[model samples]
Target: MVALKEALARNGGLWIGCAPEQREAPSNELVMHQRPDFDIGLFELEPPLYRDFYLGYSNSVLWPALHGRVDLIDVKPRYAKAYRDVGRRLARLVAGAVNDDDVIWVHDYQMIPLAHELKALGVKCRIGFFLHIPMPDLQTFKAIPEWQDLARCLSDYDLLGFQTRRDLSHMINIFRNTLRGELRANGTMGISGREVALGSFPISIDVAGFRELAASGADKVSPPPLPRLIGVDRLDYSKGLPQRLAGYEAFLETHPQYRSRVSLLQIAPPTRDDVDAYKAIRSELESLSGHINGRFGTVDWTPVQYIHRALPRTELAVLYRLSRVGLVTPLFDGMNLVAKEFVAAQDERDPGVLVLSQFAGAAEEMPEALIINPHDPHDIAQAIKTALDMPLSERMKRHSALYAHLESHNVTRWSTAFLKQLTSVERIGPDGVAPLPGSTPWSRTA
Candidate 1:
């Protein structure tokens, strides 16, 4: 939200997002924090529509498919209808307040169809979209029942943004091969005569914010007797909690000596309890954690501390600082900010090593980290070993690099870069510094 505020500092405006509550709630910044610039609108959905649109289409279908888990997709006609209806309602809600020059930037897969609906109503404002998840492979994307329509709807935007070049390329292929949209330079695409600029704008966290949080007055929970490895994630299947536990288990199995010298602290806060998959994953993780702890844990020391709740930012920061290794091994992620936050929270003199998943978006930015293949338990175990055994000089070097990159491409920069691209699409030339082409002219001026 700070990034959004800073990006729109010159022309302050509000952002809109769907909130699943009893009723529309006031902005937290307005009510709690007493910050005036906190202009976020959260429109509450009808119970039935929320079930269909959010729990059904957005999470059930799009969330899994976009993450390349098409097997989890459960499509229904009503879900799509609900999604479209929500978009229309959202447009109507803000249409009266939106000015002619307002740069409308809809976010994530939920708003994929929004721009198209707005265009249908002849709202000629400059609209942009950013997908916060992976674009999925062509095959996986086709699993969505209204894939073509969804692609066309997204194309209605003046610009589209993904988190990585790989994702951007996959999306480009989708437009060129599936939708038959014209491809152009600089990620600009020509789809049905509309020139849409699409590119990778990797999302990042607020580096200073995390560091400040870490420095805040939060008492350190006395560390366990052994050195710690910390993993914090929502209890989501895609986070590879099972695989991560297995990796640690394998590490202990292979190296019996470390049973007394090291421990794993996994903090998984629950989310999406409405979905059966979430409940199942939680049970499975609990079992796996118990198995690992039982097998290796002594009466004096538990090998794994499995927490099923969220902590305050300050608490998490202290934990990160105390950790000897930061274990973030998501099977697939848009951009795991945990990896960056761990780096930011480290003490410069003796920083903890990051054992990151190669499948994560952070892997691209964190080459110095001990990257591992999440699918291979051996690789993860080995990476953990490497991180733990890494020399102080090497740890400092890796953390320094990681911290610098996080500071450079922080959330503010990310928002500014994407918004700049979104607003400057017309300035692009025939080739280079632009994106793939479209048949339709995006604007009359172009």
Candidate 2:
């Protein structure tokens, strides 16, 4: 929504399709709802279709699959029917709202099938679809009962975007091998006379906004009594929260001298509480934190401060600035924005080190980060020690490189680059499809 709002503000004449309930409410970035003469239209769908098709099937089935949790994918005949029905309904809504020249950008796996439905309805607008999560490998993808149908449905889009080259490659490989679709060298797939361009376009944070927040003295609201280590993440199974707690405990055990002087603050906002796996992971994290604090607590100080609630952006920025080290260890993430936010909030005179996970997509771009394997508690512990103990010269060099990269490629740059490429694809019709325009073939090693 943030990206769309920014894009629309720069270039108006956009009509968004959202749930009828949100029609009257204005978005935080744009006052489109308050604009009584706005062309935006909200449509209604049956409650069962919204709940079962979108929330149930799309999130429960496709979400886990894309995130590499093949075990959690549950497919029923009714769910597939519900998915198709909702897709058709959304197609009608989009068709009604769009014109031939309008560029339709669809977000995430929730509306994968909608592109095909839109094409079927003769909506000739250039459709772009961006998948926000990891695309599972072929083996895991094939495990889904309707994988072939899903792949076919996705090919209807003019351009398809993924958070990383690995994700885009995985999708291309699946279509070519599993679905037997023809793949062009440029990552375009041909399925039943339709061509879709596949590309990697990682999402980014609002660098200027965060920098302004940090510069405006909003990041130093209340200084901590002592130097602090912080970890901010959504409470999810993929975040490796238990491992992070274990690592902090290991750090405490390894460096007993710093125990009383340094403390760790973990701010995890709970999400997907309805899912059994998510609930189980949250319980395990709580148990692990309690065990560590019970064993390591002193008369006046606790080794770990765990808060399982959401903090406002300003407060989080303040916490980021106060902390001496930003610990971001996700087991698997498309792109962790919190890592970038932490870097942007730093005071250049005394910037904090970022302990990032190698598995996170952000690590591919921010190589200066102290990358570690989240599965190894010892590695994480040592990284923490190294980050805290590093000399000023070394810290400045790493921070400089990371900060420059982040500033150069802010959210505006990311959105503009993606939409520009998508628009270029639209200008050149399906017949103009070629191998990726300018870059070398994307490789995992690269």
Candidate 3:
């Protein structure tokens, strides 16, 4: 959200999305918020339609399938129709607002079919799409009922961006093996007379902004009482929260002397609570945390601190700076920005060690971190022990390497590279001369 908002503020475009406070209304009016640099348009949808489209299809069906949990996908017969209906409605709204030459950049899994719907309405504009989640393997992706339809919808885009090379390769294999698409020499896939370019663009945080947050106001808040290890993530099934808690339990059981000296602080805010899977995970985490605390807590010390709510970013920065280790072990992630943020928030003199998951996309860039297989509680426990006992010199060296990478591949660079590539896609006119994709040629002058 921050990256796209900054991009719109700089490049001058209208940001359109669903309204935050949706009510049961029949009118398709777009509520407008006019900013100095850009405009935001929020459209309304009926309550039932919104429920089926977002909660039912997007979260319950596509979310699990994309995360390689096809067994958990609960797709009703009406879900496919609801998804298509929502896309058609949004396309009509967008076609009415956009110009003929505007470059449309769609984002995430929810809007995969928007470009196809837009083109169906006779809108001849170049549209690009970026998928933020991990693209599943061939058999996993093929398990989805509407795989063919989804692949067809994806081919309508001029370009497709993924978070990692593995994800990009998986997508390319799907196109070549299943769809019989021809891979050209220029790295574009030709299908149904349309050429689509695919690339990996790992998203990043605003490094300078986060560093400012970390550096400012150190005296306002007191430091933690114990040697803390932190894990901050949304309360989702893919985050591996239960396994993380179990790993902490294993660490304490194996290393008895460090029980009172160190603690694991896991901060996970609720997400998609209305879904059954989310509710089950939340219940499981609560039970596991309770069990760990009951088994390890003394009169003066608690081994696990489970916070189920959100905290301010400034407070989080302070926590990250003061902790002894950052435990980010997701089973699979597109790119966990919290790992990068932890690196950015560290003190150079005495930095915290990072225990990351090999399955996360960030592991590709941050090889200096102590990478562990998240599926193994023993591996996570051993890595945590290594991080907690590492010398100050080794910690500083690892943090230095990680922080330098974050500085070079910050969020601004990510957005600039994506938009540059999106605008540079070759589109020939009637006279064989190519122009810029968007109305205003993309420039960095702003």
By TM-score, the best candidate is 3
lDDT of 2: 0.78
Off by over 4 Å in 2: 13-40, 185-187, 426-446
Residues 299-320, candidate 1, lDDT per residue (tens digit)? 8889889999999877888889
Judging by lDDT against the true structure, name the best candidate: 3
For model 1 the TM-score comes to 0.91
**Model 3, which residues run further than 4 Å from truth?**
428-446
- Which residue ranges in model 1 land beyond 4 Å of their true spot? 1-11, 23-35, 217-224, 427-446
Error of 3 at 318 (Å): 1.4
Show the lowest summed lDDT stretch of 10 residues, model 3: 437-446
* TM-scores vs. true structure, each candidate: 0.91, 0.88, 0.94
Of candidates 2 and 1, the better by lDDT: 1
Backbone-clash count (model 3): 0
lDDT of 2 by residue, 368-438 (tens): 99999999999999999999899988888898999999989887887787788888873344443333322
Winner by TM-score between candidate 3 and candidate 1: 3
